[model samples]
Target: MKLPKRPKQHILETASYKLFSSKIPDEWIIRDITERDYGIDCYLEMVNDDNELSGDLALIQLKSKDEIEWTNKDTFTHYGVDISTTNYWYQFPIPVFIFIGDISNQKLYFNSVHYTIKRNFDQFVKQTTFPYKFKKSDLFEGKDGVFAFKFHYYYEKYRQQFENELRFFISNLQHYKDFQQLHNNLDYHLGLEDTDQIFFESMHKNFSFLCTYFNIDNPIPKLRDIKKKSREKFGNESHYELYEHDLTEWMEEYEKLTINLIVGMKSFLNGELPYWLRINPTIYNYVNNIGDDGTLPYE
Candidate 1:
């Protein structure tokens, strides 16, 4: 009499969960879906450095294999995506990750659905079945640090409109230095000229794009005080030196703000920073406008 036995696929599925979960850092929570899973298996919610729960989440689909090839010399596929599953991925508000675990070696690999589609839109959309071929660089088991940077880099693209032109902006700032040789040398971007225009424009574009992408309800913060301080010079007009001084100071503040915000946002998704602190919204957010007296407006 043949006895009923657990299928090999079932055994591999359990092993895959164990293998993948073991690789994930303990601080991150893996929440299994309560509803029937058409595609996504679980969400990986991050735990910040303060030992607090960060509400940021990324959807994850987990798969297991007895053995997974890290490289593909032949025309074999690592995974396949069909129309129904592709549509489900597009519906997600945040990035979706697909993690395939090698149960045999207890190793893991990952692919970002968002990044993939962004780089290969035509192939992704036109194919009836998108065959995913894994490159050796797709390995994720020992590269969580790299993942932190990638998460921060691509997070904005998810919310951006199809016609968004933020990527067109470039940066090449000039500084006001005290070297005698450098002072006399004349470049077209002379005496912080590049920075004066570029910095202002960059800041404006960055803030505007951020507000539109994030759907901020309030207006951006003003540099009214900074602008006011510049006009108090001896001639009742500002010189290049004043602009240089103010720009340098503001750039330092902006640098700190950029680093801190990147840490908070990047750290939230991937838990890279050990002391990931939550940023206050008021530090970056602003009211629609202040009162005529320039005092805080009423809510």
Candidate 2:
């Protein structure tokens, strides 16, 4: 009598589990979801060398096939998924990964659903085919037969993009004389309330981007501090007066601090120093001296 062959899905899942376990034995704990899962096959937890959980978790949707159709040199078009399924994955608080395994080639490719949503919003439309391409090596780093996934690794990989965007925005503020101009009229024509509101909104947007990029917790206090200091020096003057009096100085100072922060982060990512030591000394001192609960020391 011959035994029944294993199901295709079971074979794929087993192969994926084996690959993950073998590649990242030291840094990840893979848990198979036995029950009927909603587009998720497994949960992976970031772990330390001692097998202690690092509190970072990710949901993975696995797809395995003998071959995948490559739409182009750098892109693969996969089967379409329903909008509801995509939305469900999008709503995950933690990161979500879609892993594709080429069983014939013995290779694996993965992409982040979060990043996809950020970069390609149209892909989430109902009945749209999923495109898989960009391979982020930072998602899985291995050395000396040990592989691990860390949150900082992902952030560091994209730090340059964040820095470039921020630098461009700040540089425009420095060179554009009409940075405060809302319409064709000069800054003086704008009411104080309107000026304050516009500047605050812009600053808030930029600061929010920085905090999200760096995964900073409680960044509002720092933003408030910058605004408070500018207000104190510039006073409730005309928009032009505020710009000329102190806002310009504040922007210049902020640009410098941003550059320093990016440089320090780069160094830290390169293994020169730990994350705690990567903070700009001036900001670190300010946060420390102010005894602010918002800016907690990095863990």
Candidate 1 lDDT trough over 10 residues, lowest sum: 169-178
* Per-residue accuracy of model 2 over 137-209 as CA lDDT, tens digit each: 4234355223323443355345556656555443443323244333223343333355555664565466556
TM-score of 1: 0.56
Question: Candidate 1 lDDT, tens digit per residue, 121-233?
Answer: 55555746655555545666545634652454356334454123322321111121122123233342223565455646556456445444333332333565554565553
* Backbone clash numbers for all candidates listed: 0, 0
Give candidate 2's root-mean-square deviation (CA, Å): 15.1
Off by over 4 Å in 1: 72-76, 142-244, 248-299
On the 0 to 100 scale, the lDDT of residue 14 in model 1 is 80
Q: Which stretches of candidate 2 lie over 4 Å from their true place?
A: 1-3, 48-52, 68-72, 126-131, 134-253, 257-299
